[model samples]
Target: MTATSVGALLLCRADPEAVRPPAHLLRERMLLLPAGTGWSVLVPEGKPWRGEPHDGPDAAPAAPAAPGGAEPVDRVMGGWATALAVGATWPVIALWWDGDRSGYTLAAGFRRPVGYVWLADGTPAGEDEAMRTFAARLSLDPVLDVQELEALTRQDPEADADARLRELLAVLTRAGVALPPGLAPGEPADRLRTAAGVHPQVERIEWAGWRDAVQVELDAVESTGLGPWVRGPRARALAAAQVAAGIPLTLWGARRRGAGWLAAGLVLLVQGALGLAYDRFRAEAERGARGGGPVW
Candidate 1:
């Protein structure tokens, strides 16, 4: 596959506001925009997989290189999808295509990701069970959606890999995914960014440092009426669990040099740390308001 043909899009089953915080945590420069009624899309501004320089308007100052030369678009995106979905309430689906193959990876909270691949010529290279799992996780219409998805897995001379992805998306339209114009499956990364960039409601996502991210996250939680759940023993236990899971996962990713796993581990660690700190600070503030020692 040629570098120019490599492209990907992240589809989150939530609105832009709900997606903004986690998108920031990915630390990649991206364009965020509404997809449809309840879906949001994130288009990366840099081509980390190809290690190609992006000259897009929202491009990062420097594109990150894959650990050992350029990584395949699907692998890189799968890792990113996992990282994004692990800490989110909704599922994330990453659609990626290199010149030779096109496929998708769907990730939900702590669940094994499921995907199906089609060769550039439209040959199916993945398992059938994956389609069923995909349908189930997305909560698509069990019979109708499952039938449509299953059909894609079978032979079809008319469908190339690109066409296959498009069909896949057609099925998702029933679930509220409406990708913006010019953001088709086979388009290159630059074009996808351009399309998303021009969107009226599009917002740029960048690394804003831990302090800001935590504050934003706290605000999101409170706005969602989850503040009470963010504290207390139950919250503490969940936080500890995340920390415990993160350390080894981080080491394992580092050892293997897998960016996706690495990102997932780091996210877990950050969320854990943020949860613990948020609980403590809130407790202190409440105590101070009750005439205990100053909150400082």
Candidate 2:
């Protein structure tokens, strides 16, 4: 299959660890790596649209129903983007392509996703409404941003997918997304990896085996401000829910050969276990700090 058929990049304004949760939620086997300052890239290993996880209640209407059937790609990207954006302080963008089309979706917070589309030949196929929505969702200056966006849509129809993506990137430069030299759109996963590894600003994210990974996660928690939730009843509840949800998810993914979902379940398990551990650690630390005053 060609690059368009199997390759996609999910860009998020969070670190790779923060990016993993939502990607797992989408059940996609994506390689996570740093993409430049304040950004991470998720490279989907397989076609994400084939067996997308259900989006539950807040899901937008299915993508196949979208104009020109562009929603299939959009939904997966949108779902992942929205998952990362909600309950966080950053936005996520999914740049995707299939054999016949290419487009992008920008999701921020709980607001609706806005996207732009292009035909396989690079003909602009998205509605002006999408650009308007895109600008609004990002809180861009109404006059200046809209003008730049409008100019993008008005680009020469003969431009190819690569050109279109470049134009999109140009528009996003202000948002601090400086993708590395080798992380080009439409490259196969292997080629994408080879390039990303040597790029000065890119770092290949890996399991580093479970023990090291877990320790790294614990260390991460120390630097984050999740102390209240991680030390309270809500953290316990969330950890329990993650375990409960992860088992079935992992089983289901294994049965269906869904690498994405399987990875997602594993993440949930890790997060849940870590939350519990962090809470216990906090309790112990508190007791020690207070001279072991009855162990709370």
Q: lDDT per model, in order? A: 0.87, 0.68
- Assess the local accuracy of residue 225 in candidate 1 as a C-alpha lDDT between 0 and 100: 58
Which runs of model 2 end up more than 4 angstroms from their true locations? 1-5, 20-27, 50-72, 197-220, 225-296
TM values, all candidates = 0.71, 0.60
Provide the global lDDT of candidate 1 against the true structure.
0.87
Write candidate 2's Cα lDDT for 160-202 as tens digits.
Answer: 7667877777767776677767676666556665666565544
10 residues in a row with least lDDT, candidate 1: 51-60
lDDT of 1 by residue, 21-139 (tens): 99889888999999988999999999888634332333234356557676667778999999999999999999998777789999999999999888778988789999999999999
TM-score of 1: 0.71
